[model samples]
Structure formats: C-alpha cells, structure tokens
Target: MDLAERIESLKAGLLGAIAVGITFTFTVFIHQTLTVSNNWVLPAFPSSFEDLSAWVREAVAFGSGFLFGVTYRYIIRQGENPHLKSGAVMAFGLVRGLAQIESISDRFTSQPWLAFVLLGESAIVFAVAAASIDLAIAWRWIKPAS
Candidate 1:
C-alpha cells in the first residue's frame, strides 16, 4: 500500500497518537547520540559497535516504540474514540520506559542464574508495554480506526 493509504484509516488517530512521533524522534536521537558518543575519540565500546552487547540492548530498547505504536494503532482502531493528547503520549511513554528497563536488565552478564533472572525481568518489561497498549485501548482513551 501507498504510505498514505497504509496509514489512512489510522492517520488521524496516528496523528492523534501525539506521543508516537515524539517518542520515535527521541528514540532515534538517543540512538544516534549513543552511537556517535560510543564511537567518539574516546570510544567506550572498544568491542566495536557490532560486538557491543550494549548496542543489542539499545536496539531492543529502541524497538519498544514500534511495538507500542502497533498497540496504539490498534487502540485507535478499536476504541471508537480519541484520547487526551497528553494521555496518549504519556501512555506510550510508559511503554517505552518499560522497554528501557527490560533492555537494561538484559545487558548484564556473568552467571546462568543471572541470565534467567534478567530474562524474566526483561520479559516483564515487554509485557508491561504490551499491557499498557492494551489498557490504553480498553480504557477508551484511543478510539478504533474507521
């Protein structure tokens, strides 16, 4: 579908999504800043950007926005109502924050037990993101797309 058509049903609601745009912009900005800073003359990630597990963690954190957006879009499609701009933004923000927590948790390494613990912690974060999106819609803050 054309970009316009693909998002057509939800465009207004997508635009209504308010925080969706800002969240993505900030995510990209942070990713770029981290990438540039990590590769700066000082170079904290001596393992190279490719090998830095931190980058992987960062990637998951950033991807949270996509999952949140999917939920937000679905919310708009199902709720049949629009939401307070700030509420929608904040809702997505929460989802992103949860993702950040999960990403950070997954960054740790050392023991098998620690890995399992971190995995569960990160999964919880992702679950929160998904749940928030579901709740944001269930709460009727975002209307279903027409």
Candidate 2:
C-alpha cells in the first residue's frame, strides 16, 4: 500500500477501534450489572471496577477492533458485498465466542447461556466497528485501500 493508503487505513482503524472500545465498555458494564444483580454467574470482571484486568481486556478489544477495521476496509473495498461483510463479521465473532465457550468449565455448566451472550456481544462489537468504518468511508473521512 502507498503512504496515503496506509494513513487512511490508520485513520479508519482508529475510528473503528474507538467505536468498538466504547461498545466493549458498555458490554463490560452490562456484565458488571449482571454480576451485581446475581443474574450472571460468571466473574467476567473484577468485583471492583476498572481493575488492571479490566484495562487489559479493554486494550485487547481495542487492538482487535483496529485490526478488524483495516482488514474490513479491504474486504469490502468499493463494493456492496453483503455476503463478504457478513462473513467477516461472523469470522471475528465466532472466534471470540468460541473461545468464551471453551473457557467455560464444568463448574459453569449451569450457565451455558453465557456462551450465547458472549457470542452475541462479539457479533455486536464487530458489527458496530464495521458500521463505524463504513460511515467514515461514506463521509469521505477515509478512503479504502485500492
């Protein structure tokens, strides 16, 4: 890619990452609320909010979002390929959701539904990131790599 294309990708990636990061934050908050309400049996977050682990998780999510943004730009470059877009979103979401499912132990067997929740959350995050990238492209704030 040329320097201009690289810069545009960087800008679009940052925008998408920020958008996904916010979504991640909200998901974490939802998890926290569920924990407090005893509706969720998983310890996805620390008892105290904004702990070191929480920040690390958020950082990872943001980094993943940036990668998704750059890759998605090329995946849908200048075309309306709904199949490819859906596939891309499913790829990311399933990878994350499957990991969550795998992490569940026998002790968490009663809470099998957690896996679906995590899977849905993953899909939502990526979808939001994709939408943000599409918006940036539509607004002419960034151009897809040619």
Backbone clashes per model, in order?
10, 0
lDDT of 2 by residue, 80-133 (tens): 989998898889888876776776655458776777777888899999999888
Q: Which candidate is the best by TM-score?
A: 2
**How do the residues 8-60 of candidate 1 rate in per-residue lDDT, one tens digit apiece?**
43433333233333433343455557667785221211223455564554455
lDDT agreement of model 2 with the native? 0.81
TM-score for each of the candidates: 0.35, 0.89
Q: What is the Cα-based lDDT of residue 98 in candidate 2?
A: 74
Q: Which 10-residue window in model 1 sums to the lowest lDDT?
A: 40-49
Between which residue pairs do clashes occur in model 2?
none
Off by over 4 Å in 1: 1-59, 68-110, 144-146
What is candidate 2's CA lDDT for residue 26?
86
